[model samples]
Target: MAIRIKGYKWEFNLIESPEINAWCMPGGKVAVYTGILKITKDDAGLATVMGHEIAHAIAQHSAERASQMTVAQVGGGLAGAAVGNKSESTQAIVNQLYGIGAQGLYVLPNSRKQELEADKMGLSFMAMAGYNPQNAVGFWQRMAAASEGAQKPPVFLSTHPTDESRIAQNPRDLPEAMKYYKK
Candidate 1:
């Protein structure tokens, strides 16, 4: 399926967590938590989520983030009191910049440009696989419902919020996607 959709064959593994998560590692490796299967419901939803995951690989977002973090660390080291060695203040600034201050680590969020690019790419992949791109809406609706009232929404939803604009705007891709649908 990954090959059909993303032009890359994939290998799968199981993860023991209730995170409702999945990712496509750099080398066509795919790991999907059992927890997500409930909401995926059918092949179309699974393909939607998988396509999005594959987009991360295609766009090299993970590598881009690692590069940014490496540059930031290097810059901090050169700036003054050896932040690279061990400096609490420098680490704090880096953490905040990377959105990981709360965890005392470096975490990066995808830029809005990257997010939109992934959405378009994923939609194209699903369409290429003969999944109705409209099903992407229902997939996210289920995702949003699954996260209701949580202190923090799921990480996936945190990054891909189901705002009015995103929802209303997404279906517009259907005309483009339908051209690829076989059924």
Candidate 2:
């Protein structure tokens, strides 16, 4: 099936990995690991995953993230330089503050927004493609459960939305997404 994300001539690869991961790279390269299929369990579930990944590419999220990181790094460097005349302990404190402030004020929030955007757009895409968008909720719930015992960075430091946040928003978004469904 041709995914209709603009500016992307999609190509897909099935990698033989046990990792439950999938990604869409710049220029429309997509890869899915076999392991995630175990969780997906059905065509609609798979569509949920594929649609989300494709949405990332369609939104040019990677480029935006890189740009944000570059800006943060430059700003951090400038802040560090301005504090160079301070004592060593003061310099360390400034560095830590910069790291935390940049992450909280820009990076993590942007990432969470991107994830939410992808969720919304992916649901619409799947609905347009005749997949049931409601399945997304179940798929995400399963994904969350799967990660329950795994160690993850705190939400403020992580790039993706916590599973709980993602799941919580699905019901609210599903009604809008279903508007795109043909049947």
Candidate 3:
């Protein structure tokens, strides 16, 4: 696998939890809940999850998000500073609008964009690691089934893209990921 982990120390842990979830934190910390193992079913399936999470860390999604939030906060602070001399009600209104505008205009949209990017990169990484990227589709399918009865927010309000959307996008990503496969 040519996926570089040179600069950062990577750690992977399997947690004994019922939630079928996994994540990679910035700086290469990774956790996979045992419940997700059932859905993974095989090495390829596990690779899909690990690759996706690692891609997030590799892409520095958290750093991007933190920067974005910081910018939004600075904008809010500026706005509040400008309105410092105004009436209390005016200051309150400006702050409220800043919160809504910051989230709707940039944060939410960028979050969804990051998820798609991670999905693509993860697939490639999986293939490079000698796992068939095609197996990712089944992993996502099982994931969708696992959460079938759960409540999901509207796409606009959600941080992560829908599983169905991810599933749909997987095929488009596979050909590219296949290029990285050596065997």
Clash totals, every prediction: 0, 0, 0
Estimated TM-score per prediction? Answer: 0.69, 0.90, 0.91
Q: For candidate 2, write residues 1-183 as lDDT tens digits.
A: 245355577898999999999998986788999999988999999999888988898888899999999999999999999999999999999999999999998999999999999998899989989998999999999999888899999888888999999999988999989999887
lDDT of 1 by residue, 1-119 (tens): 44534655667776778888887787567788878988889998888878887777777776876786676676554543435565777767764554443112233234434565666
Candidate 3, poorest ten consecutive residues by summed lDDT: 1-10
Q: Tell me which of candidates 1 and 3 scores higher on TM-score.
A: 3
Per-model CA lDDT versus the true structure: 0.68, 0.91, 0.92
Best-performing candidate as measured by TM-score: 3
Candidate 3 lDDT over residue span 76-174, tens digit each: 999999999999999999999999888888899899889988889999999999998989999999999988999998787788889989999999989
What's model 3's overall lDDT? 0.92
Off by over 4 Å in 3: 1-5
Q: In model 1, where do residues sit more than 4 Å from their true spots?
A: 1-9, 14-17, 81-113, 153-169
Q: lDDT of model 2 at residue 75?
A: 96
Ranking by lDDT: 3, 2, 1
